[model samples]
Target: IKTAVEKIDIDVPNWTFVAARLFLFDLYHRVGKSTHGIKGEPYCHLKEYLKYGKEAGRLIPNLGEGYDLDDLNDYIDSDRDLLFNYLGIKTLYDRYLIKNKEGNPIELPQHMFMAIAMFLAQNEENKQQRAKEFYDVVSKFEVMLATPTLSNARTNRHQLSSCYIGSSPDNIEGIFDGYKEMALLSKYGGGIGWDWNQIRALGGMIDDHKSAAGGTVPFLKITNDIAIAVDQLGTRKVAIA
Candidate 1:
């Protein structure tokens, strides 16, 4: 694959494009053709993928409640597949593509772009139009959304923001409060960044010298524990103090 990829030059600019298509073919093979009730269709079908995926609990519940799933079919840019490099296509397929019950990729790259576009534009006044506009930008990779948006949008558990930054106050009560906040955010797949500056240094006095303090290290242990406990959706464990 590397050798083939390296051969891509001005003379053969589409080498990576052909490779990505082949890669997508392999991805389709790994999963079943579950487009709604039309199983094993031998081809990609966006609406069917959504209907079946939602029914199977692998997708966001009632994602297409009021929207016309068929409209999305028109917005998909089939040529966008040509834009992906070998690495880009592989990364997306490995990490982002929606899978079926059999663990096969049920949606194509274009379907994913449309799903995210519709999801983000769901609340807009002109949702259908907005979705198309959103799809245009994203499919072309002109503008990038945040990590969670890229990862969770248009999915069963749509935690679409990336990071949460809140300070854990100096006191124990405040620290625990921070823990609760972190837990909630982590549960919804957020990376946490807590302010530890408010807390005292190592071996510092605790509670106005009521007794010797374990300082930030003990508290940090708690933070570390939270990071491990709230491991974000098997994707990553995240926290930064």
Candidate 2:
């Protein structure tokens, strides 16, 4: 992988694909050994994979139940794996692919895409067909899902919204409540856009007393701490602005 990456330059940029393929080979070998005790074919036995994920508490309970797993498995084009560059595949492998308790990846890129499609189409009237259509666009890279949606859609957490905007009122209860809300949103991989304009500035009056307010900076510090503390289940730090 390192050698393939090093070989990538302006002249031979296709080396990125080489690196990705190498990385994918390693991923396939690892998952195959861990799950099936052999070097298994890619995109094979996806139903078993979903069952394993549910049993391991890595995926949503209704993931495979809502769809025909065999049909969905057939929709997966293992060739789509070739479409990803090294950086893209690496990012998905590191952050998005469902992993076990020991942090080994269990799902491939197509599996992740199919899972997201199945999840998003779960509420549609013709869900099975809708899921196939969703899978077509997503796996073919015709549409891109937002970061939170891509990361959280098929997982047990399932909070797919990308950003949360909230207003923080001036009072103690309101301010604390806003912090709690931020923590909860951040825990599920949502970026935060908080309106602290309502908060009092430095040296502002509190409870009709003169100059009792520590103001927005201190609260901002606490907010920063919360972002660091609840970091999207350790995938990445919460983005707060």
TM-score leader: 2
Model 2 segments beyond 4 Å from truth? 37-40
Residue pairs with backbone overlap in model 1: 31-104, 35-48, 36-48, 59-156, 60-156
What are the Cα lDDT values of the candidates? 0.74, 0.86
Q: Candidate 1 clash total?
A: 5
Candidate 1: where are CA atoms >4 Å away?
Answer: 1-15, 31-43, 201-211, 237-239
**lDDT accuracy of residue 165 in candidate 2:** 97
**Model 1: per-residue Cα lDDT over 26-131, one tens digit each:** 6555545344333443335666767766876777875666676677776576778778888788888766777766666766777788888888888999888888
Q: Which numbered prediction scores highest in lDDT against the true structure?
A: 2
Per-model TM-score, in order, reads 0.81, 0.95
Displacement of the residue 173 alpha carbon in candidate 2, Å: 0.9
